[model samples]
Target: MFFIMTISNRKKQYIETVEKNITKITQYTIFNRTFRHNDRKFHKFLVEPDLNVLVVGIGNGDLLASLNPAVGVGIDISQKMVEFAAKKYQSLNFIHHDIDNKIDILKHPIVGKQKFDVVILSDQIGLCDDIQKTFENIQALCHSNTRLIISYYTKHWEWLLKLAEAVGLKVKQPEQNLLSTTDIEKIAELSGFEVIRKEYRQFIPFPLLGLDIVFNKFFGTLPGFRRLCLRTYVVARPHQTHEKKPYSATVVIPCRNEKGNIESAIKRLPQFCDNIEIIYVEGHSKDGTWEEVLRVKEAYPDLNIKAFQQTGKGKADAVHLAFSKATGDVFMILDADLTVPPEQLPKFYQVISSGQGDFVNGTRLIYPMEDQAMRFLNFLANKTFSWLFSYLLSQRFTDTLCGTKVFLGSDYKRIMKQREFFGDFDPFGDFELIFGASKLNMKVVEVPIRYQARSYGETQISRFRHGVILLRMVVHAYKKLKFSV
Candidate 1:
């Protein structure tokens, strides 16, 4: 009985301290407008519009309102903060609940027993009484596909933040738990979440016209500098329960001039799935590749095979056309050159069917390549772009130019709908899929494969021209993805 009483007293004291700090900050924000810029930066990178969001530690509901979630609910422990938020943002629902204690989120009238697409802890995880318990409570509001986005300050900036607070540059922070990224990841794992992507941002919070753009947009994302950034963001999802379910696979082979390898490519493909569909998208091949595809389809009568002559130029157009007609649950791309072997298709299928990753890409850099498979200049270019794209997408990729890529059919349709945003610049088709997968917040996984030299014909790629095109695409991505509002 004494221990229970002491626990209750501690809870009461913690709540009172948080309440006092929140009240003081609310007053401070009303007078000082620049303080809210920090929240705006967090909103810019993390929050997307039209999601069903439940923001914990939603102070004044500003960040929650800014996201424009279709179903928005903001929660805070302080009643005064809830009241203020309710009045300021009349459209959003505000709840006054202590997250540390056991509370049924579904039972809340405003939330209406609905599962949210996104559950955001924001900067409030530091203030929670039990971080693991808080995450456990959040699990009730999530489904398998639900994403949890967390933003917190790096412990490196603790002294600088304290100085800012003392000098009246920032709001007075309450006594809170300072957590590192690894610490948060452990807590998330213990509470049934899997970390997907991690990023660091905001080298300078104060806005300057040209300098802020250069520092935050370019310099802050660099390797060594990013570690010292003021904020850290992590994207995670619930640990999924996998079941044995049969999935159909479609292999899209984009061919331009590989006539000699067509029959071998068809014969070498292993029967790995319950149902396999082979699609030959012949891109106006001058070497009778389309005729060879038709002959192969007729010869392999037992196999489900379809052939199409692409009316448009480039591999991207061919992929888009083939994907539009694809019927299988899993969509895969295999270059007709047979650089990455058809035998490796099973590994891609297993990754997707077992729920390991939503988008699986082939990596040629890991395993040794066959003699004359890739030139020295090409290898160096691949390495350079891989680093650039890894930073741009916040996902690590060793070989982004690998033609072998796999994803779901439904996701392909969604990506096709938004393809106009990036334009028809990607002739290779690899970046389009990679960029789209990253934009949709899909888990990207890479499988290493041996790169083989093509025996049928000469390579179609022009090194210098394609390198310039890739650089242009990167700049476009920066504007569309990194610098966007």
Candidate 2:
């Protein structure tokens, strides 16, 4: 009986001490970059600006403050943590609120008519009794492009955590309704959302403080670490593609010459996948390209093909013009050259449905290309840029300029607002897509497919001049996304 009473007292003390330490986490913000990296890979790569946001946990989040949010909201069940954080970052909005109580997310005035650009729920998923309801409510709380970055501890960390609780250094709250990474993905996907990025990290961020970095890192890096890691960070966004109510997609194909492949391309492309509308933005072509596009449109009236002529002569210019005319939940870029087949578009569609990634890109490197498809000099540049971008963007992209990319329409809006950041210089539309996708923290995944050299037309990408321009983009991204962020 005496031992039981002692254990109960220790548990109480553990909660109290954790509440105190959390209140003063500004001291740990220096170490928080590593924390952010472990949560979102590209965040540490510094390709993104600090995200301005709110966290529904104990204390004001210094991590959010570092991002220069227009307003930051930090809430916690404990008044002690709220009070401490209030004094720390008094410039930002900090609220003392109990997450344990019933939350009518829609009823909240801050999100009633207005939703946050980003919302965070860190280290407090287990405190809420209704896990599904909590997320469903959070779903209601978000605008279309709103990003939610959440971190949580799982059952696998329970033993070590309980020991820390006994030592009065940690708190083990009751398992209200614990969930796995896959569980959360399913919940989000079913609720018109998808996991943009999911990471299992830091069994213990503070090695000397808790489990020690060695054992923590080992388990954290393990396969399915979500099965054992002390924490998980999941970034979810609205998956624009769904069956409940079919949404529209604008497939923009920019072609300059390449009449040889037009007939095959039109025939091979997916006719209808869920309200897909095909638009051909034909640039100035020396060949009979306009005639071919017209013939194809006449052949397939059911495809909803609209052919538009652009006065400008660049890929980015063509894309921009077509995008202004697009009215869809999703957008796609299909090169008129048809190096990558249109048949593979369903795979890109599947990527959106899977919720594993947000931006779908065609990767020609994974599959062998036809003879003379990529010249040696161009191949060298491709390899160099692939490595450079993977490091610069914190996302793996096997092909940087494959002429095929897709993303949600809402994300496009977010990118459009930040378009001035990367003026109108990208002729191939590669840098623009990559830069914007990384900025929004969208997970960019490669969809491997075969590549055939262009069947017609000369390549507009100058071997030397454009190569230098491309190189400059890389250096600029390093300065903007990497070092600055």
- Among the numbered candidates, top TM-score falls to 1
Candidate 2's TM-score reads 0.66
Candidate 2 wrong stretches, greater than 4 Å: 1-53, 57-72, 80-117, 121-146, 150-245, 295-302, 353-356, 423-425
**Candidate 2 collision pairs:** 46-481, 47-481, 207-213
Predicted candidate 2: what Cα RMSD to the true structure? 8.1
Estimate, for each residue in 152-216, the C-alpha lDDT of model 2 and write its tens digit: 76656667767765875543454334577777778767756667766555655553554545645
Instruction: Quote the lDDT for 385 in model 2.
Output: 92
| lDDT at 259, model 1 | 97
Candidate 2, run of 10 with poorest lDDT: 1-10
| Model 1 Cα shift for residue 175 (angstroms) | 1.0
lDDT of each: 0.81, 0.67
lDDT of 2: 0.67
lDDT of 1 by residue, 98-184 (tens): 655545455677664878988888787877778898898888889877889888888988998898889876666656688999999
For all candidates, the clash counts are 0, 3
lDDT score for candidate 1 against the true structure: 0.81
